[model samples]
Target: MQPPAQVPPVPPPEEEPQELARFREEWKAELQRRRAATAATQASSSPPQPASSSESTLPASPPAKVFVPVSVSQPRAGPSKNVLPETHPALNGTERPTYVSPGLGNALSIYRQAVYAEQRSDLDEALLLYRQAFRLDPHVDRAYHREEMLASILQGQTAAVKKLTVSAATDEEVEQLASNLQNTLALSKPVSTGKAVVTGTLASLISGFPQELAFEPENELESVPIKMLPDELLVLVLKKLDPTSIERFARVNKKLRVLSLDSTIWRNLVSKTYRPPQIPDIEYMIPVIEKHLSDFRRVYIEQPRVRFDGVYIAICHYVRPGLSENSWVNISHLITYHRYLRFLPNGQVLSLLANEEHSPQQVIPLLKPSLRMKGFFLGNWHLEGTTLHLTNLIDASGRFVLQGLEPPSSAPIHSHLHHSSNTTSEDRARYVFVMSLNLRSRPLGRWNRLDMETYESISLETGDATPVALKHDRPFWFSKVRSYGLQV
Candidate 1:
């Protein structure tokens, strides 16, 4: 047999538009059919308008249909205006994208539908409405709140970035705050004269909070660049700062913290008092963290950073928008590892119950380590909140207690402490999953007013409950954090 009818090798066929064009036509036909079916159903669903029999005489006015954004009830902060609308490319050699607003009615109509759905418990519909509202005006008031809630549930803290700085409320709070806003353009008002008086004369205060002056500039005290120092020296400096302060130093500069989230500092945080014989890098922190802490783990580091102490955690979800899922996963793992999770990536010192049974057990892992959930600090937690993540701090006492933080505006302003009652499970629900710390020191030396401006807080029974009770009153959350080998 002639081996086989030798057939010339077939050349690979060139791309063809025929099949592609055929698919396009098919899609178009299907879409048209769907529209036709929709129209037919609408026609059949409504009864014919009585054919205007006998040319009716009475004039009937159409109903007034009011329009509201879907997330109209969510909390909102500051003023927002349309910034970007469409996905237009940057003008210059920049990659930043611009938006093109498609007009109000077009977007507002969609928003109304979403709000309608939310009213009916249609979560998906509510989400769609928020997206539409964003399209109408990225800066829409309640639109931001609605969007944040969706993002928090869907994407967690990593996505709660822009939302945290703006909206933080349930529907009612949104309405009241919007009306209370004194200016549409300003997010915050000037420091009240009373506040200034209080903060200015804090030393004489009774010692309410651990410290109201959070590392203010002290003469030559200055923050230095991480790049300027040697890695060894850098490591040395980081060693001295307690884990809390080291985390704060990381956020002081995006580039700085981004570069510092390595094993050196994280490792030292997990260990048993690993102290560096010598220290370098005069200003800022980093070195202090390495020297004070021990052990390191990969799970504790990420772009949406978190730094912590035994009682508190600083959640840093300020990463730019449009992050990949993998990066976000690592960001979230810290929450699971630490266990006491804060929904938003905002950070705060958890008050450590040093004597609590569930307190942390020191483990040797990274040879440098900690974000101890249950531990002792100054005493017990009182209240905490913030507009942005407060990851920056200084815990000089080393009991994993927070030593540096500005007093809350109300702290010094109010001369007396306010009390809140939590008698049942419902009352305690708010504190269940939050990151916080309480400080305790026997009635050391009592003073009526510390430096005249700052007033001291006494006991919890006598402390002010207003700060912790009105959750919506403040634009912050008690952030949870994990560190080094503490990956749960």
Candidate 2:
């Protein structure tokens, strides 16, 4: 066959549009020229670099970054219209940014991390981090608190600020506010005190009711038995009811509401119930009632008293290092415990400390000195102003004595060494525990939280006192126990 007419190899069809190919080629050429010009400029203007010394003798500096245009092996056919070219110094090579190594460096940040560890019960880690933070900056805690306060402000959490403002108000401002509150209450059509809603002002509401102990029957034929009682007899009957009973009776009608708010009945209630029977009613306590400006209702509501129909509970947690099977791995166990305090009307208080395995429901019924739970102790308690004091602590059964803090100074030193000494263990275990706690309310009206201020073991024999550490202890919060009922 005649030699195939030489056919020129058909060129591969254009992989991309002609416009795109031409633009990409032009870009490549422009980049090459720019690089060449930059190199030339640097060579002409820059001083020659000195020869590096021996690597072992001189510390080597980090390699300087060279600006190089990236080349695409498979060139993009086209650029997306939505995507913008890199312009930020952080994104492109226009500027070299300083980089911090990945680690905790700021003291406030470290302190915050320590607080998180503490909340998680990682005690050891928390302690270490706390020390590190304090060592780095002694004021780290204040800094963290400032940051938190700023954040709260920015988040519109102004409750704390409002409280601060109220506390900081001048005496005149406070008086003015109180006057305003009274005027508002008096002018309002109705007043709600949770138990009852009274329509109109107290004065006007009472005016509509009969002043004398007489009631007009709803029906002409109906007989009202309560209308027969004289005002004096009626007051005596009301005074006999407890404060709670009187409040319930007040919800019956407007006449009963007026009788319930009587200064005399409330005054009698305050006198009878304010001080615990264990504590003598002192002359000074009278001034406390007078401080309410003769408003016995205010005194009755504001006076602090321990609740007997409930228990104060504290939940505590700690972290303990555990024995690990693997040497390289660390093991930790989170141990949770609870503390309970039940007060009896007789001034006897029962205390118990139990583990997480015991729920409150299971523990509440047994939270008496009679049950003799593992951590049970009995103590006498009394309230003074806003402080609750517990003293004369003895274990349940009243026979489990405590170890003496120290021997009496009058005793011979040799007697302590002799095993057969006349000194008995009972006499040596004569130390009494005394705890003072400050009472606070979580909400405005309820006196429900107890924060330990001081705890001491006083030796009756030696008269020496030793303070107990309360670092890890939490505040006790009151929880109502219906089983206890209204004992006090």
User: Compared with the true structure, what per-residue lDDT tens digits does model 2 show for residues 137-246?
Assistant: 77665445434432322222122123233333333432332233232222223433322233324545655665453355778998989887865577789877755678
- The list of candidate 2 runs beyond 4 A from truth reads 1-259, 276-282, 326-329, 397-430
Candidate 1 lDDT by residue in tens digits, 333-436: 11111112122112122222111112123211111112221121111111221111212111211211121221232332111111222122122101111222
RMSD of each: 31.2, 34.3
lDDT comparing candidate 2 with the true structure: 0.53
Using TM-score, give the best candidate's number. Answer: 2
Q: What TM-score would each prediction reach against the true structure?
A: 0.18, 0.44
Candidate 2 weakest lDDT stretch, 10 residues: 66-75
